[model samples]
Target: MNSVTKARYDGLADWYDDRFVTGAEPHQPGLLELLGEGSGPCLDIGCGTGRNFETIRASGREVVGLDYSSDQLRLARTRTDGPLMVGDAAALPFPDESFDTVMVMWVSTDVDDFGAVVREAARVLRPGGVFVEYGVHPCFNGPHVVYNEDGGRTAHPTYRQSGWHEPAPWWGEDGIRRQIGMSHVPLADYLNAFLTAGLTVQRFIEPEGPPVPHSLAVRATKPA
Candidate 1:
């Protein structure tokens, strides 16, 4: 991730809730429900503003939140009563099998080293521990870009591989903004990454929750 993008989010920390976290549009609740309750330490990767900390901790599990943005960490501290670390998802500062469960919710694609992050998540998880994540639907959700005036209605690319090469488009209620995101990885990449990392596939769901044509939820377990 670029320092400028990190800084931009850092600057938006105070108002991130309004800009993005007001509701469950990202489906954190459904992911949590799928994870159920586990009696072990939990590591939340890219835990911006600790939005999911309370729910994860409510299951009587010790929670540790990590994010790369300092400004976002500040907001997380205010919202959560758990340990917080200003750290990178690709380079987690913990020992092997340090956590009982690792959760990466809706933030993997945003990361540059998506594979490394997944590997690190598996490394920190204990034997038989679960690793869960939710990400944008690469199939139906295309990169949408909205330019000022001339850049009128934008369309999400129908295909993932080809579309990723093109610049992503975005149009918020506020105005037109250009977004640069990662390549649209296929479902196989997500599955193979965990399997290659030594985590056994437990569940894979492509939720059809209306308005969201495609959203993925994956749960894998490290073999004992």
Candidate 2:
């Protein structure tokens, strides 16, 4: 994780937590469905403020949350007694094959290298272990796409421009991207991370919502 990203999250932890206190973000159901009832021990990368804790635990998985921001982890501590840590997603602090399931949620935009993070998630996963990714739909959601008042979207020429982007005027003043900035990964690059990590893609989902789907979910597994 980039130090700047870590600091940005740390500073916004309280605000972020309060913003999602109900944990009813529209995409949560899709994320949990894609996550399924996988066996534990599960590792939640970029587990911000424990938003997914209740649902994940309800599925009977023994979950461990990890994030790069200490302040975020501090708030997470309130949501679950399960272990939580401040660590880099690209370099997880665990032994190889240490987990039965590994998940990354809404984290791709925050990491410097999404592929490296996926590789690390694969590294810590046991054979046949599940890997889940649930986040913004790269093709339609990003700095390059502008959401209009008519519930339509406009794609800008910068859609192919991948990497860290400064906040643009189009971004909502109080939105996450405006607050911490974001990294863009083209649609192919987003899906290729799993294939590159040698995982079998089992399911791909574009959850139904809004005029254009704003979220995506994927489920994969390591070869047994």
Instruction: Identify the leading candidate in terms of lDDT.
Output: 2
**What TM-score would every model get versus the actual structure?**
0.80, 0.95
RMSD of 2: 1.6
State the weakest 10-residue window (summed lDDT) of model 1.
171-180
Q: Write the per-residue lDDT of candidate 2 for residues 11-57, one digit (tens) a residue.
A: 78888887865456633756677777866678999888888887688
- Tens digit of per-residue lDDT, candidate 1, span 20-105: 66664544546766577788678988888877776787666777898888888888888777789888787889999999889886
Q: Give lDDT per model, in order.
A: 0.68, 0.86
lDDT (C-alpha) at residue 82 in model 2: 93
* Per-prediction CA RMSD (Å): 4.5, 1.6
Query: What TM-score does model 2 achieve against the real structure?
Result: 0.95
Backbone clashes under 3 angstroms, per model: 4, 0
